[model samples]
Target: MCVHGSNNNPDIGQLLEGLPTNWGKWGPDDEVGALNYLQAEQVLRGIAAVRQGRTFTLQIPIGHEKGEPLFPGRRPSMRMNVLDKGHYLAGKAHFDGNVEFSDDVIFMHVQGSTQYDALGHVWYDDKLWNGYDAMSTIGSMARASIVPIAERGVAGRAVLVDMARHRGKAVLDKGETFTHHDLLAAARAQGTAIEPRDILIIRTGWIGSFYEREAAEFYSDFVEPGLTFSRELVEWFHAMEIPNLVTDTMGNEVTVDPRSGVMIPLHAALMRNLGVAFAEVAQLDALAEDCARDGQWQFLYTAAPLKIVGGTGAPVNPLVIK
Candidate 1:
């Protein structure tokens, strides 16, 4: 639980067990990490690939009853809406032209559903991405909030690494781990090449389990089929310079690590150390099916997190166009 300042020399290699990081690579004041690689040319390349005007929404329903929250202390969203008739009559005001109007308010955890993790979401050795102070920089008046991500607007060429399809399964078994080797194998099988600044979307088929089992059974064990935070994967991500990674599973990586015995190491390593963002709980089944039908795996993907200042994360509705 050691906290280091921006200029302090923290033993990150020892902490991550020889895994190097990109801290200070962008700059001392840099909040946007690997995302800086997303250039105008990349966006143009993504748009140029759109032969068909088909679009897919990669976000789950905000209040999906079947898909419950997997993380503890994160509850389902609650929405309360008042009908136009009840509201208009209650307000004692006559509508001018449109007599009916409805209003609703929602309250829920940002990470409870399909969401984007801000750069300030994770920290290692008491420091955040680019050596930003974790403690003092994530509150009411802090740096590296969701504003930068919102301002940048994640739109680029996205490649889907369909793990379930590669394994020939509807859904991966619980506790199964997809490693770096598997990622490359999946890409090779799909005839796709990993590119720099590409938005990587992984479909584990874990969300199918949520629909198959009861809510209690689905969320009880906290076990899932997801990527493994292996040193090989970290090295590959660094080498490829991927901007963001999204997965259908709640946690991007398997919760129980058999190798290092560390939990959520990918979160700390990617977000905290390398400043790579993550979009969790993505709904990729529809997109995967469409890609399979068209034999086109690459698409133009865009996501914009809520512009909540000082917010750690925000629910997102990502759009993929082909």
Candidate 2:
């Protein structure tokens, strides 16, 4: 694997010092992390926010003929044919009945497409969310896996903060950064309020650009533009009780921290320390345009990932009902 950070990278522990943690806030055996905030009441809140009957699916299509927007080191999902008319014609396959069937298999990183990351996806100090031992992820994720999230599901009111539109840009420049303050500013500009415990869906237009440009240009020096880590930003998440963060980027936060030169510091500060769930690589162009035209930014955000046992993450098509 192409590990991006260096031996000289600042210690993640020191990088996240002075930030609070939600490790045991739920319970000793807590495994879903911040998804615990998404209770029945949150679902009711989501239903109430549905001002229109319109719906939008936020997942990018997997196995596009051109390519997929993936984390730098990860390959695209590969679809292999199992059986088809061609196989029967070649006399290489047969069915029990007087019929021919087709089957196929896929090889992919659970996180290769738009997906929800496990709370234990990244860790430090030899621990995962809720103080689970990092060793539990040795063979397959035993604790804090995506199973809990997929089984529980995520349903809540969501606000899409379109940073690209707010900045008057079609797409934010590579390696660009934003903070919670920027989120609030953009929400204000959009005339929307970010309520407590709302599913936060942010759009930088990074993932959407994959279709418009060549893969070489898209992945060159690929540092995704997104949320930047800070003590204040982490504190804002804690105070707001933001349950799930959805975004149009591989890593929710900027790929590298400018202040610390650490790769994805928010993966530790927010996902690990604050227990915030991450849903990354969403396609939000359609949703953003709709919200922009209608001036209604809040919606009922609901997603259920494939319930794969021992999966670190699972593909999902998040639906925004407005």
Candidate 3:
């Protein structure tokens, strides 16, 4: 079924009633959510895990000609040249210093590329993370915007749970789902364990497939195959103290819940309630392949999102150093 056409979905508020929450766990004014778990100690731990000194940047190019993978309504970034050789040749521009440079402006969402979502990105029942009022997001994300996340930054040990590789497929089928148990199994198979507060990066090979297929074929029947929400899965994340969730998919989880027909309950169940930070649309193909080859699944993960004030989210290119 299509993501938007969920047949008789349950009330998200009622559907998520009584799920565990981290509201006020830090303080009444807290904003960065579980990323607060990444302190100096976590940074040191990340450094310790870096043995090979290999660095991989995990972001897709912003302005791909074939078009970037995006959610249904969002459009790809468009870059327009304001100053370039053409302008200079047209005699519309001249430099006294004989220096010419190209300048362009990009028009796109703050979440247009690999991005880190603010705690207030989504909510229900008139509240965001840390019990902030839902109305605080009016006009801009007046509260719990991505600024705090960008300010603090994220650096820590991360485990790559290559779900697509674990399942012996180049890409998981559309709408395929996995849970905490599956994550554990995949980690075991990869010869690693997901430690507490670790940045959890999962690969479905979904984003990698975009380069190999047409945008129409990719967006067709676009129920992204990914983690399915469950009480046990939520509890596992809380128990593990996971600081961030990174994935190659757009929504980061199965686009629509099959049983409840709810679209991305994890956005509410984990992010809104439990304050788990989300990094979506990451490019993880090369990293996953190397991890599989070397069996080095744990690495140093670092990301610094642009400090866009009042932004609901901001573009980021996370680094994985092994």
RMSD of each: 4.4, 1.3, 1.6
Ranking of all predicted structures according to TM-score, beginning with the best and ending with the worst: 3, 2, 1
Worst 10 residues of 3 by lDDT: 1-10
Q: How many residue pairs clash in each candidate?
A: 1, 1, 0
Against the hidden reference, what TM-scores do the models get? 0.90, 0.97, 0.97
lDDT of 3: 0.91
> Tens digits of per-residue lDDT for model 3 on 1-322?
1245355777898887777889888989989999989999998999999999999999999998777888888878899999999999999999898999999999998888999999999888898888889888989888999999999999999999999989999999999999889999999988999999899999999999999998889989889999998888888889988999999999999998887888889999889988999999999999998998898999999999999999999999999999
Writing each residue's lDDT as its tens digit, candidate 1 over 1-322 gives 1322344333444547667678788777777788887889989989987889899987778767664555655667888774556767677546688656667888888777788888878766777777777675634528777778887889899999999999999888878898878988899898887777788999988875677777776767666788877677888888888899999998888875656556677888788777788889898998998888878999899999888787778888999999
| TM-score head-to-head 2 vs 3, winner | 3
Q: What are the runs in model 2 whose C-alpha is more than 4 Å off?
A: 6-8, 94-97
Instruction: State the lDDT of candidate 2 residue by residue for 191-266, as single tens digits.
Output: 9989899999999999999999999999888888999988899999999999999999999999999888898899
Clashing pairs in 1: 3-126
Whichever of 1 and 3 has more lDDT, that candidate is 3
Pairs of colliding residues, candidate 2 = 52-322
- Given candidate 2, what's the lDDT at residue 125? 93
Score residue 223 of candidate 3 by CA lDDT: 91
